[model samples]
Target chain A: MSADADTKSVTEVRPGATPAGPPVGARQDSFAARLRRDWPLLVMAMPMLVLVTAFWWVPALGNVIAFQDYNPFSGGILGSPIIGFTNFAQLFGDPQFIRAVVNTLGITAFQLVFYFPVPIALALLLNSVVSGRLRAFIQGVVYLPYFFSWVLVVAIFQQMFGGAGLIAQILRDHGHSGIDWMTNSDTFILLVTAETVWKDAGWGAIVFLAALSTIDQNLYEAAAVDGARRWRRMWHITLPGLRPVIVLLLILRLGDALNVGFEQFMLQRGAVGSKVSEVFDTFVYWSGLRTGDFGYGAAAGLFKGLVGLALILVANRVAHALGERGVYSRS
Target chain B: MSTTKVSGLAPWEEPGSLAGRIGKGGVLALIVLAVLLPLYTIVLTSLSSAGTVNRVGGLVLVPDGITFDAYRQIFSDSVVSRAVLVSTGVTVVGTAVSLGVSVLGAYALSRPGTLFHRPILFCVLLMFVFFPGLIPTYLMVASLGLKDTYWSLILPSAVSAFNVVVLRAFFMNIPRELLDSARIDGAGEFRILWRIVLPLSKAVTAVIGLLYAVGYWNAWFNAMLYIDDTRMWPLALVLRSYVVDSNPLPTATVGVNGFGHVAPPTLAIKMAIVAIAVLPALVIYPFVQRHFTKGVIIGAIKG
Candidate 1:
């Protein structure tokens, strides 16, 4: 939302923006001279560039393995036979892959409906509290779980809802049968959404809370002066003030729709079975690691990455069309 | 907080009705209790004695007999103890390296019009959207001969583009006059970043460092992927086996179980493992809690 945050798109390199430095194309602005002046800065940036290359860029290029009949042991990436669209052809034909895509998209839509409003509600509720001490205490308690790993979050849910968990124990004590919600595939989508809410609702609210704080209180007062009711003030002033943050996050979430997370589903895949638990990431993981169909898995993953890229660009365009600054501002 | 002097209301705002007050207070308290109750139960179960655990049948709620037997048992076990050490070392070293590299990168890219900064920043942003395919990354890691090594856990995940950008935002927010003042005094970018920028960025830096440390501590998948050797597993992976999978520790010191024997209950030990895994995050949270409003939100939300 600031001029500093948006580097003009990659096509444009405006050297005129440099501060207190010699203008580009100047006699002293040659590469060697700039390197002499900024060698330390380049040195500082070297480690990151190297790590990003080795980890990010190289492997991104390696996504080409998706196009090959990749066998890690015999052929490796280089020796693999090229098999254009065959893996993807196989991917689209497979019922299991179809199920995974459906499940992933289903979970994304489900969380958007059930889980997305939680942090907004939490921020509004927290903002209403008169006591800062109490609000901080709630934030500290709630955000604690966000730092916990998926293994730990799932374990906590298990302790609360597993067959021998506290709720089950309580039910058994009351002469009812104990049910293992952890293994209940029928409600797996809801279960994961609940888990997501429990872990992230507070952390997500931090963004909204920031937006809320930035809201002009005078608007509320003026609305009140005009005989606007509390709900009216909230609707007219508060929600609109938080609109940009909400839209930005919504776009980001839309871009991330295909990725419902790996470890969460992978951990539960045993209890819930792949039929219920399979998402895009776990599909790639299982088809790659478990079955060693590296090319097949790579194809599925490549499909996901490309779609995600498309989704983000499209979402950004949509946001621009809606007159909001999306992830990055365009004009 | 800005309107605190006006009795929790902006001067022009109306006071709440009794019903409204009751409703808000009730809902807020419920949210607080929902979060705390499970945590309380886990901690209580971790401390419960064998008799106490059986009395509750699972996840001891009412505290009857208090003993450190479960904690003592897990700590005494070589597997859990060594895993704890591994976790601590990885968290420390990984967090330091990540924070160092990220801060250095952020500073280098912090200056807006530096040489090739735009192209480099664009590269970072490009990676921010599209991660490398997982299978490809795994193959790369395996090909690099980093399998089963701690470096596999650290290197692949060290430089998060998100964190770097957030930190860079905070750095960029610093008044340019401050940096220009040092530049006018003939101080280099390194000297200026160290003396002027870093000193002013302690809170954001601390929050970022804690985020990395917590990430490193809580990470298990990397270890699960790369370090198949249970002997080299971190505490989180161990926690998964014992707590999530309900698998017994191979080196469990108190494997024998009876109703009221001296050994802690199996449930208590499992819960104890959960508690141990959660403790570092719990301990480190409050220190960073102070920075959430000031540092994290501004770096993240405003950016």
Candidate 2:
């Protein structure tokens, strides 16, 4: 479908713009001619290109400061003294930084196990609801939190599960000592995963639901006619049909492995303590921006970006190796 | 998939055993309640009067009485009211700027064979893989002297690559004949877009606009990093400080002794703040929800 979208009808505009030629040859129009013809289009595209370059590309290039003993107020990014591999060496040696990495990976892994299947289950559950009105109402209720900011989400959690929250208040009423479920450092991973599930599971199910709708219902009919039971039909037809989408989303998730999200961790850092709540992002925020250690922080940030890029590439490659269309196909 | 059953169950689908049906209904009820109950507490507690709040000693699980006093106090407070204005202003202006830039860019990219189209689109797609670093993004915004400015909240994060991609996809689906036929009528690309494309694409456009608006409304991290001045803060940042930080909101603390009026309890005041933060999403969701699901499906569109 998108392939059709990218085909150029503009080449058909110019009398000499040979539609018969290869796409490469057809666009061999002189720069000045092309400029005169396409300046409006370029003008339209300019703002986006300029802003993205300024905001995204420039800062990305500026990660070179990761290698420097950079002081922004003094030398700026340019004049900073170039130090070789020192920041990275220090980053590796820092126990806190190591912990942040481990914590980030741990959260990602835990969520993949415990939090990932929730949306799929939600989609199946919602799918089985006999009434469309009931299904839509439930979907409307559940997807509400996806729009909430992490602060709002954390606030809700605090009001529900914090030291003086509903859960604790009820526990106290039941003659049990109050439990501050939100601040339990021992199960920080589980706490985060639960919050993630609450915030995202319903919204995530939308994609699975979409996939389910697109599945051939006739397959189910055939399976039923062939004497496949409900569970057997679902296992054979429903899951297999959802497989491509499931794989694509899984690959995308792997690409985002390093990000356990920033704001959720940052907000909770003080409450849970840095030992438990600090992830790569909070580490950068505190060590780099907050403390003015730009070079050291830049190093951590660079490490994360590079590793994330590597992970996505590797994950995409693995997906391609499997017989699936993953995020982008080899073709 | 069949809808032939009297109970809305499909013919091929099993109704399940009695216990199974009960279990499913109960689970669905719990899931629905999990969302509704917390929301109910926050909203109800916000409405609970000072006397009711004091008696509950917590979130008023059930409202003894309803009052707008908490909201009245919140709006009366300079800090929160100004922050509300800031958040609204930012959401409006930021969503506009983002929509304008993204729509224009996506239109440009939608048509193939534009000069540098491939390169520009590649740059955008590259953003999905490589993000700007935290410190560097901060430094860039700071060095640009946007620190403490409202544009700091809007510009650095204005144009979403995903939105652009979605818009471009939707634009491409407008049958080529329509745009070409318009071209034959001497319509410029912008005119064609303004007249033909946008008119045909309202649902997706609104959906994208909604995404951008919600993003602007929910964003606090940028305000946190850039607008160090507390007075310039948006509602989301104010929410983080007053609600999440659990710092006593000025209104509840300042009470009759200072402001010469009874204030609702802090817990009620806090829930009111949360209610303020959340109300927009709740109000806006139902209106656009029909489009929202379609938008999500579109977002999952692959090249």
* Candidate closest to the true structure, highest TM-score: 1
- After TM-score superposition, the amount by which residue B237's alpha carbon in candidate 1 deviates from its true location, in angstroms, is 0.7
**True A-B contacts kept by model 2:** 0.61
Question: Which sections of candidate 1 miss by over 4 Å?
Answer: A1-13, A17-28, B1-7, B250-265
**Candidate 2: docking tier:** medium
Report lDDT (Cα) of residue A255, candidate 1: 79
Looking at model 2, the pairs that clash are: none
lDDT of 1 by residue, B1-303 (tens): 234422556667778899999999898888778788988999999998878888778887777878999888777667778899999999999999999999999988876556777767877777757868888999999999999999998999999888898889888778888877788899987898899999999999998998899889989888888997777999999888777877666444444332223332388888888888889988888888888778888887656
- Candidate 2 has what TM-score? 0.93
Q: For candidate 2, lDDT tens digit of each residue in A134-229? A: 888998989888999899989999989999899888888788999887788987777788889899999999888888887877788788879998
Q: State the displacement of the C-alpha of residue A81, model 1, in Å, after optimal TM-score superposition.
A: 1.6
Name the runs in model 2 displaced over 4 angstroms: A1-28, A329-331, B1-7, B249-265
